[model samples]
Target: GNATMGSGVDKHALERSSYEVLTGAADIRDAITKAEQAGYDLLPANADLTAAEVELLQMPQRERRLREALNSINGRYDYILIDCPPSLNMLTLNALVAAQSVIIPMQCEYYALEGLTALVSTIEDVRDNLNPFLKIEGLLRTMYDPRNRLAGDVTAQLSKHFGDKLYRTVIPRNIRLAEAPSHGQPALVYDKASRGAKAYLALAGEMLRREEMASAGA
Candidate 1:
């Protein structure tokens, strides 16, 4: 099993290297870049479902693996961030089934409100159809630009609608964030003084405060 997993990563590495290391291209810009290099276009790498993965549900083996993976991670960490494939497939469904909370990272933009409705609907669907315990942990404002009038309007709307569910910390757009992944590290490791790094640190502290309050309540 580990061999299979290792090979998969090696395949991706070769795919990524084919452009960056060998051909000396842009080193696969984003997640989409790497997916395109692997000979698949329009691949749902973000947690969106496809037809095939849903069909595989007929096999009990798939379900067993899902359950096992979920059970394995329980209580092993304080937080398990499941970056689901950008599709509503079996994997996404399994993640929804397992996770008790969902943290949506969103940018403050004019059309961002339109996107939140879809995500909120999906969470509602998951709660109604699969995971009853699942609730939105919060909506984190990412790549925030306070100078943008649209951003301010969107943030105000979010605050009005979700109140405390809108985190006070807003992550500003920063080059350091764009640079860190190239070195295979978080922005904190790459540039502690960067605005993005400081924002994330503030988010962490806010989350910790919530955790403390929850523990006290318990």
Candidate 2:
């Protein structure tokens, strides 16, 4: 999941929170903050966002609230990534409804397959019921260790099952990537030369290349 706020945020510029925007108490624009170092605009969230899960349950068109909020700024961004909590809930449903596609990142662990199965089922349901355009963009393997036999086995299985949908770039386990969140910064800003940072850069390049190929095919 993406960090809610980067270290570059100017506290003085803050006005509204993601909770307020999701709950209809504030406009999405009011919750947006510029993270100059990260080179992206962020709608920062906090613990208060948890309350929105309950509050949204009582509201009409709860699953569509986020989609409605983001429509106003749809033309401003080329990509809008919504990082949902690691669970199936109203928040995740809202994200599914709002997104065009999903990038699923997972570790090469035994339990990860089970989780992926459940997540895929959820996405299929969402696609069928809520968003017809919703699809799985790709599966990203993260924290991969080449020396681990289990990891290699899982990766091979994933490749066999997912084929081209599994990204070629794998994010190796690195200390810098793990520490970046504590510093409220990305691995690229923390240590651009680190293996983790380089892997992520490669992933970005891969994604761009895929998009170009897709466009060409289209």
Best candidate per lDDT, number?
A: 2
Q: Give, for candidate 2, the lowest lDDT window spanning 10 residues.
A: 5-14
Off by over 4 Å in 2: 6-14
Tens digit per residue, CA lDDT, model 2, 1-218: 24654445544345777788989999998778877788898888777778999999999999999999999898999888888888999999999999999999999999999999999999999999999999999999998999999988998898898899999999999999888877778678989999999999999999999999999999
Q: What lDDT is reached at residue 122 by model 2?
A: 97
Candidate 2 to truth, TM: 0.95
Clashing pairs in 2: none
Cα deviation of 188 in candidate 1 (Å)? 1.7
The segments of candidate 1 whose C-alpha lies over 4 angstroms from its true place after superposition are 1-67, 85-90
User: What is the lDDT, from 0 to 100, of the residue 42 in candidate 2?
Assistant: 87
